[model samples]
Target: MPAAHHPDLELDDIQAGALAERPSPYVGKYLLLRITDRADGRELVRRLHRIATASRTSERTDDTTLTVAFSYHGLEALGVPQTSLDSFAPEFREGMAARAAVLGDVGESSPEHWEAPLGSTDVHVAIAALSPDAARLEAAAEQARRAHAELPGLEVVWRQDCYQLVTGRTSFGFRDGIGQPAVEGSGRPSTNPREPSLKAGEIILGYPDETGELPPMPMPEVLGRNGTYVVFRKLHTKVAAYRNYLRDRASNREDEELLGAKMVGRWQSGAPLVLAPDRDDPELGADPQRNNDFLYAEDARGFKCPVGAHARRANPRDSLYQDGSVDVRLHRMIRRGTSYGPMLPPGELEDDGEDRGIIFVFAGAHLKRQFEFVKTQWLNDGIFIGAPEERDPLVGPNDESSGFTIPQRPIRRKLQNLPPFVVTRGGEYLFAPGLNAMRWLSELDT
Candidate 1:
């Protein structure tokens, strides 16, 4: 069935950066700021309100862009009324740091080991600048810098430079930014024909969600309408270790590539294993129309794309429909990822101390049901699929006891003793308010 269309959405008041699809081969940066002085902070927001573009404009242009969001503490620092603060979702108020254990951020991925100021209360506001090239990226960054140039109360606490690898792959050597859910009435087409555009409330507040009910929003109708929750995470990828593990398991070069594809459920070219089960089809991968148009209903047995693969776990599609009780749309989110740090020298199996990984950003209305549910239920546990001990093979926080199973002919092949391939550097939960909401913040008397 086609998604219910919402024609009356307030696109003009929504931040373009929140719904705009990033350009290919882009350059970007994340700036974490602390508001030491409330008055100056309001002034910063006022300037930013003028600089941030609306989604209506952002969708049409391929130029540099700026996005602004505030953490829970940020709103409190800026003097948002107590009742208004309490109106927000509890998950957002407690923040990502407090929910670390629920997110499987244990062992090396725990909050104690996270980079300073990321999970800390000091991170007030987040500014992201993205552009198609270096010059444009700098142009966007300059615009952001000018927003608070004279504000002594606001300080840039942390910054991470990010870009798309020339090959358009992450540190893990596989294509990223695939399968983003399209928001209803956003003037954007769904990448997957099998997946309908999500109801507006699934991502933006104040609209009826899949259940035909309005998702909870922050207090004050103007403050929450058209606003969305944001999830920012820094994941450090262990490239060499991933390569070494596959190398030791596979029989030959081709087998090594297949093994990696099986783990991710997609070839490095972005071709899904379910569609190109035996070999990769680069042309198919390059074509967005065909690449994501597949569903897992045909591969129920996991002979093609393993049920435990990272991509499959991230999005089960129709694979879980047999239960009839679950609606996949409720757990969907808008996921965007950009690579940071230089790509590890290709074909090198030895560990290099350089830090390289992906800066993952998620936009959704229901943080717990959409983002957190997927992380804890789908990616970290396998009970839904009948395998209780498994997690996502490629990115799961697996220890020596972790394993992945690939179902095949005579006997199923299982890879044992999987090590953790990705680690959480840090993260935060923020609220990206509508443009008018931002204006409200700037003019706040409280």
Candidate 2:
């Protein structure tokens, strides 16, 4: 039997899964799995369906919890009909390895060069866990272990622990997880009031998107409804290298910090350069609503927030409003990242041989328009803003030819031969299905 598709979807029926999930002031862990037993895989899906109530509740979940997502292959492994898998987005179907170069996953970032556990094709499931305390985290881990035990075919291959920093900043000491889009009807409050609110379909599948079109859904309607695509990239940040570059290019410690801010277009406190161009404003960064309120309308000339800055490129809010060449709303994504390694102490310019970086996760209804388009067109290219050969100062390719240019009054200053400070250790494109969809997968004919 084939699953029937529906053209429209309701909001209340959607799962409170990862797309709109908010950050919690606690520690987190991610368990990546690979399926080995075909029959047992569906049994695992059944087990997950049994706890569907406990799952997909909220991102700011209470202590001892986990959220689940599966790759296109994961569903196929569990005997999902080929038709259901075929209806998913192309990128989701092809997987991340095939699109690595377009995503700037070349060189050290390539999956072929990743650690054994990450590069393998056996990767299937992703479980995200969060807790208020370590004891609680361990208890949750035990619970997760017991749950996995329900499916003998499920194998946990890779595990990474992500913790919330006290300063609410990434390993680079800059505030992240800000400037995310607010999906309409997702129940999550908007962070930036002035930034446009995207349609529910833009972030959640089955709803009408910004273009007034509902994205394509998998068969049976139930499996595809309330689902969204996710791109999970584990980025290893070279903290000392980044700090050294800033230090060397700057005249003093203050200048170094300011230079870093210029690279990211935000102060360590989360203040946007367009608002506080000359200094760090902790007060502005503290306000969730006000911090992201400013836009690139008045700063289009690259004087305030350098058109090539990482943050500006990632989300060129008002800058493209007049251009009409690209629709920013259609490309908006829900970005959530957590640092995985130990935090390098402030003012420490030396490397401690510790593995520390961010686990970057982006969720959206349209993977190509939102995540892929942003990565290739915005983050990797400078032509949209005026600089043709320039790359993002913070995380761009930074190859020998890649450099960053800052527009100034006297004369433009260009930093040449910038080295990449971030490496894509591992990543994948996943389908985060609704709770009912989980049930559909469990009930599918085996």
Candidate 3:
């Protein structure tokens, strides 16, 4: 395929789970299912196809974006060839059960420790329902349950619901869902034009990615076209403790707010520190056009936004160019996060003992390079940023020796003994295929 000649995608057939600009103030429910008999797998796929939604249209007053995806085992149950399965990404082929410890999902979240529905041979399908309206969201979820009821060998294994914070904040209180990469042909352009455009193959399969070659995909071109991989992680945040940490480190309320902003690389209002270094600029943050326009090239000294800050490490923008222009667009991911459980009441500064965190969804064609690499290299290590052995201040695993420093005049302020605020509960890797693939699954012969 020519680099300039972009493919004409059938957006109407692709699942909306990976689409950009999904409905806001949304509620999402995840479903894990089991396929009882290979003989019934074909029928099961047909029911699932009937329930899943196509990508969103150009104009819509409202939406309940319902989507359905399947694990590698789910496809195998539907008669996909072993050769095709082997063609998938290695980490995905290994499945979440084998990759949990490497991903830091241990202790309470290890495969053995997970609920029966997760990491089990019987578990197959993964479905997601997202909607701005709670009633529509609930109805879509029920529709999936009823559809499952009609299939003989299908059983609903486990379910969990996650909702957007009313303030558009994640459990960490930073404005979420910023800095997504723009794909070559996807109508949703990049938020920052200065940032390079990523090839469609970096996200959707069957297209040319950064290597100028198509990523290895499953058998049958129709099934892989417009299809992409998705990794779901349920991360539980210890909210009150995080707030307390900030409060304890700062001298006054104003200092506390600045400290939190410095750690996150953005204010609660979503204004990046790189652009508004000294204070939180609500107007600049609220302006979608300007909020994500800045990069870290000028602030390499960590004077504006610290090099190890959460947002900088997560995307980096043009920060890595000085060392010979590191092309980071290929490593991008479409990240959609929603906080679950009850919010800690305002003005309280202690552990509330409530379960709450973000439901993290990563969409891309290259799982290892985009998702796994970012977690292990960018977020977990500081070598690339000139700070060796350091990790992200907020999300990195607690070592009791970790610290954060804000570069300022005279003496830089440094805080130590930073503890991790988020813990992994459970997660899975799935394939969100095109509509044609759904039809193909339904017709696969025993």
| Most accurate candidate by lDDT | 1
For candidate 1, which ten residues in a row score worst on lDDT? 1-10
TM-score of each: 0.97, 0.94, 0.94
- How large is the C-alpha RMSD of every model relative to the true structure? 2.5, 2.8, 2.4
Give the Cα error of residue 431 in candidate 2, in Å.
Answer: 0.6
State in Å the error of residue 439, model 3: 1.0
Candidate 1 residue runs with Cα over 4 Å from true position: 1-7, 53-60
Give the distance in Å from residue 327's predicted Cα in candidate 3 to where it truly belongs.
Answer: 1.3
Candidate 2 TM-score, C-alpha based? 0.94
lDDT of each: 0.91, 0.79, 0.79
Cα displacement (Å) at residue 200, model 3: 1.1
- After superposition, which runs of candidate 3 have C-alpha atoms over 4 Å from their true positions? 1-6, 53-61, 106-116
Cα lDDT over the full model 3: 0.79
